[model samples]
Target: MKLTDDHLQTFVEQGFVIVEDFYPEERRAQIAEGIRQTLPPWEVIADDPPARRLLTDDFPYADMLFNEFILDWDLIAFVQRVLDTEDIFFRYAHNWARYPDPGAEQPGLHIDNGNNSLLPPTSDRRYGQISTWYFPEAVDENQAPMQIVPKPYGQDLSKRVLLTVPAGTIMIFNTHLWHSATVFKGREGQRYSATRIYGRAD
Candidate 1:
């Protein structure tokens, strides 16, 4: 679906947008599979809980190790649309895989840097690199889904917190926002999500 001005406003004010089915289901499967192939068996799934990993590791530990999702024309089209640009490049990305497991607690609300415990930002910074995650599985509310605190430090931020829609839903959020995935029951199920970064052309 094309992004409307309202969508952009929501993102700027709330820090994220959950666009339903941004990609066709068939294509989403391919992207998900590509990410699955590169994962270690140990990191694959957890019936008791799920698994989480940052592909940015030095030695390297991402599922696909590349933008497999970018290759899909339809998917890229949507990405371009959301970005409101005629052209875009597929830069860096990360992946997350949550399996249907017991004792799964949703991820806590934290910014990207905060989630990873990166160096604190300077006071003048209003935004950071934008990141997007396309979840390919079905996510129900009870799953804890992904909760976000809109524009963490933005003027519009109300301290009003909210949860993102489940799997197969795509979310584009400002890195400055505090967000996290709340793990819930899905022991036998798998939640696969990937992020793609976009930037201006040189």
Candidate 2:
């Protein structure tokens, strides 16, 4: 679906926006199943207080369902509009599943473009890349939600946006924005999300 004016303004002001119901229920279910099939077995970290499992570097390129979702015309259009460029290319993609862990320390707030940033951290929105986090399953506050500081980079966390969205939601944010993931504390099941990064095609 196309972005509304409010959605665009939110992204410009807060550095991120969530597109609700971006994917249909059937498509979301298919993607979730494809990921479950493609991912390697879970490897839990023993030393961690709450058991944590991580799966990385395995993208389901062969999955036609995932391919269709990623190349969605509306998604591409949104990225192009945000970057103010017609040429946009995929930079990276990955999926993560966080199992429930009591007192587990989620990743600290950080910018994705730090150190590897192509433009100065203070550059305008068009200079940096956009990253998307897609949830194939419904996500709640206790299920390792993403926390984003709404202010510009380096600002204090007076205001924050916690991503507690339904299944098939897509959250897009500027690479330079400060954000972090929370620990999973739900009663059942792990938190699953697939993310893809895109940059201006130079």
Candidate 3:
């Protein structure tokens, strides 16, 4: 799981890096299906703030995925190698759900974090936030992948960067940075992805 030198460079220059093989296809499918079972039916509030969920229960594969990603061998190594911190505080995360296209977009654009309170936004950096942008199914131009303003937390935010590497590859990114996944355009089946926020420690 440890990132190679190439991975480190990409993370620094771009402000984010995508690591593959975080979960095998078989495991990814199993975990995605299990998490979906815990979500409410996708038929309400599509016009409002959109429907979202908070994980209050203990599920099997969901927990398994959490363990495998949150401070997994590779994640831990990444934290130590990149941030030079022995440990990172992972702030509690809320589970999220998105239906097909034409839904709400309030939580749209902008990083996973905000700072209307902190004068200089210093408090916002206490915890490093991250999420595994899990794609239960295949993603394409139509499916809409997550748009990450790579390094937006500290660099230029003039334009956003987006990419579709592969399914099951965990996108470990800063929650304090601005990002949003595109909405699916199809009219039938829905795209499913759950973000489990991980707050890096100090």
RMSD of each: 5.6, 3.4, 5.1
Measured by lDDT, the strongest candidate is 2
TM-score of each: 0.63, 0.84, 0.68
lDDT of 3 by residue, 1-202 (tens): 4578888777666556777666667878786666566654344434443433222232223556545444466665675555556665544443445456644343467654442111232323334554546565555655556677866445344567665656666666655566766765543344555444444455
The local distance difference test score of each candidate is 0.55, 0.75, 0.55
Cα displacement (angstroms), candidate 2, residue 151, comes to 3.2
For candidate 2, the per-residue lDDT at 162 reads 83
lDDT of 1 by residue, 20-138 (tens): 87766876677656666754222443423223422221113453334345465654554455455656565566665554444644455555664432436432223244567777666
From the highest lDDT down, the ranking of the candidates is 2, 1, 3
The model with the greatest TM-score is: 2
lDDT of 2: 0.75
Q: In terms of TM-score, how similar is model 3 to the real structure? A: 0.68
Query: What are the runs in model 2 whose C-alpha is more than 4 Å off?
Result: 39-52, 114-117, 152-154
Report the lDDT tens digits of candidate 2 across residue range 6-116.
Answer: 888898888889888777788778878877776532343333424245555344567666655567677778888888999988777777777666567767888887544
Backbone clash pairs in model 3 (N, Cα, C under 3 Å; residues 3+ apart or in different chains), count: 11
